[model samples]
Target: MNAPPRIAAPTHAPEAPRLRPDRAEAGALTRLALPIIMARIGLTLMLVADNMIVGHFGAGPLAAFALGLMLVQTSQMLGLGLLMGSAVEMAAAFGRDALDEVGRIWRRALAYALAIGFAGAALSQAAPTIFLALGQEAALAASAGEIAALFGWSLPPVLVYVASIGLLEATGRPYVGVALLIAANLVNLGLGLLLGHGGLGLPALGAFGVTLATLIARITLAGGALAYILLLMPGRQALGRPRWSDHRWADGRRQRRIGYAEGLSLGIESGAFASMTLFAGWAGALQLAAYTISINLNMLMFMVAVGIGGAAAVRVSQARGRGDPAAMARSAATALLLYTGVMLVVGIAFLALPGVFAGFYTGEADLLAVTTPVVAGIGFLSLIDGAQRVVANILRGYGDTWLPTASHLFAYVAVMVPAGYLLALGLALGAGGLILAIALASVLATGLLLARLVQLKNRRS
Candidate 1:
């Protein structure tokens, strides 16, 4: 005998969605989007706080933190990008009343997360050598290596959080994930202040202290998210556990099929950004620290766009499964408009308060004097960068993955990397040159991805 359909709890009780998708185009998207946007911002803010704290420790500590992040974030993004398949797949399944498949997809995602996280941990050992080869100061690179190793150990928890959050979002439970992230941020803030400042009679851990905060927060997120998942899905809790009998290799392979394109896209984009970190290192430790601050501030705003994009992805996938082209277009359009509006406001803040934000990262007059302009540049760059990021995500929601991956390669590898290298080194353009290149890449990537979205919209219609 076959098992029963495994539909989990809907936003309401366990009932079919009344089949009313008319308003889901805009209203529903916004509803799903708010909590997700807040969650993304929350996570980014926590990291920004860490940067602010470490920046005050001194330029050297900030530089070490930047160098360490160069490796950890790139790898983490790659793994998380790959796991986005879980969201897309589960959303489709949930829409089509194949909720049991959502559980299968979740399990596969967890498996991939653990495997990828451990691999990244092992690979992080090479960060020091990579930084040195990229022309970083030997001392800064060595210190960064230690921090990177600690960050590597923290990835398993981070990946678990990613997996759990994706599952929750896919199942129309983003609020739970948001709540978990908020709780984790509170834990992180307390620990960050405590361990970071050596408040309890311990010596200051400097950059290492920031990393400790990250580890503790990540553990809190994973543990909390898992408990939530179990509470919401009591019957399938056994299947959610990682067991040979519960999950199959075939399911893992199926998920990876969709994920590889996203992974490539993220790797291309992140690799280009990481190279900018190297370019800053070439300038000196001070420049690297300043660059990190500017990038961190820019990314915090970018998270708003990412959250909107992720929400759009879920809505689009569901609309597609339900065979509703109009709803899909509406979701995409609404996401673009909302993300643009928020990012524009963020750009204005960056323009108006560049020095204020720079001061948040550091109070040092010397660092602030030089960092202000860089932070201002980030404000300018945030416009196109945020646009491209969300547009790419929107396309992914339409199940157009490979094109986005190819576009990123062209934008990052072909456009940004070469221009950044030539303008920064050959012409001595410094950080300005690199950011200008980033702007170009964002433009290229946005154009390509938007073209794909247009084509998809037309085809679907």
Candidate 2:
């Protein structure tokens, strides 16, 4: 021992710990987010294309399409929120290694989405008279009615598409969902060109043709996603075989609870937006048309932020399932930071060239005059909205949905709508006042949501 002491004394230092992030989690978030972002971009492009063609045709067509979309989106928001909430639930189950439970949840969610979609479609088709009752101009009401009729036929397929995409994303195969959306969009674009403008010797069907193309694309994408889940990726640990028996009320009670809360929350928020548009309509047709154009562009940017927030939900839910609150908090923070950065860039770009962006949708001088202030308002509001969305997703990931529902009800219903009407109609600030109210409400909501997220995170800690 003494002879070997000199050699024995030599000790190697401990190896430095490698700083590999949780690769699976990181990869999962990136894979899920990128596809959603790309798909949203494609959707935005379609919107731009629609606006371009419709604007070139005339103000009436543009206004009709915009109003129709506003109504359709208000209905669709609830459905989409339900699907998204269900996806988070399934993803959490997958993280807990409960594969069968994920399938059970998915089946129930899909059933709900289908039923809701069909019912919505029927209502839109059967109740064109309802638009007349909303105090809209006679001409505007009739135009909206026609657009709603076309939307009715498209709702089921769109619902199916949304449900399938939720399932796929929950099962850690979001890329497949993205691919299907891309393919569908490509087909839609080609068909839209053929039917919308009568290219390729096809009949020009105008706005109705655009809706038809969307319906076909939705059906194709939904069918393809269903096939992939049943045949190609059936054996994944995250998605077991679909079980009809698991599609029971008892099995989906928790999911329904969360999904309904999420849906109602989003509906309240969207309804606030609808109210703003109504106020703009009261100002005049030109104001409505202009605000619609600017708001559509605003939503396109907002969707990018939303897609990122959705990815945060998946990542945070997975971490929570693994009992790692720290990782969950960090993931959410990262998502918020990323969203803020992106929104800053977008805000600056919009601020610098509001007219340029507005030009893509309309060339009407009167419309542009109203839209400029509205667009400027959005430039500031986007930052608040983008940040709040991320925080809201974090709360959702942790299964604290009811709080947000209450927050939206209070913020939007109790504050935003009344204030907007007073400012726009009562105070005669016109479209500018309407937009200002939106900005104010958004700021309030963002603050509330951020505070709630902090509290939730601290409690978990």
Q: Which structure among the candidates has the greatest TM-score?
A: 1
Candidate 2 TM-score over all chains jointly: 0.87
Model 2 error, position 437 (Å): 1.6
TM-scores, in order shown?
0.89, 0.87
lDDT of 1 by residue, 1-461 (tens): 99999997667543222212244366776777788788778767778888988999988899898889889889988997898777667776776766667777887778788999999988887888877887788899899998898888778888888888877776667778788888888888888878888877887777788789888898888988888787765455433445565367766665777888888888888988998888878877887887788788778877777777777887777778788777778777887777776777777888888899899889988889878887787866887888887888778777777787888899999889889888777787666677778888898889888888878887775
Model 1 spans with C-alpha error above 4 angstroms:
1-25, 96-100, 231-243, 322-326, 459-461
Please state every model's RMSD to the true fold in angstroms: 8.8, 5.9
Location of the lowest summed lDDT over 10 successive residues in candidate 2: 14-23
Model 2 alpha-carbon miss at residue 336, Å: 2.2
Give the winner by lDDT: 1
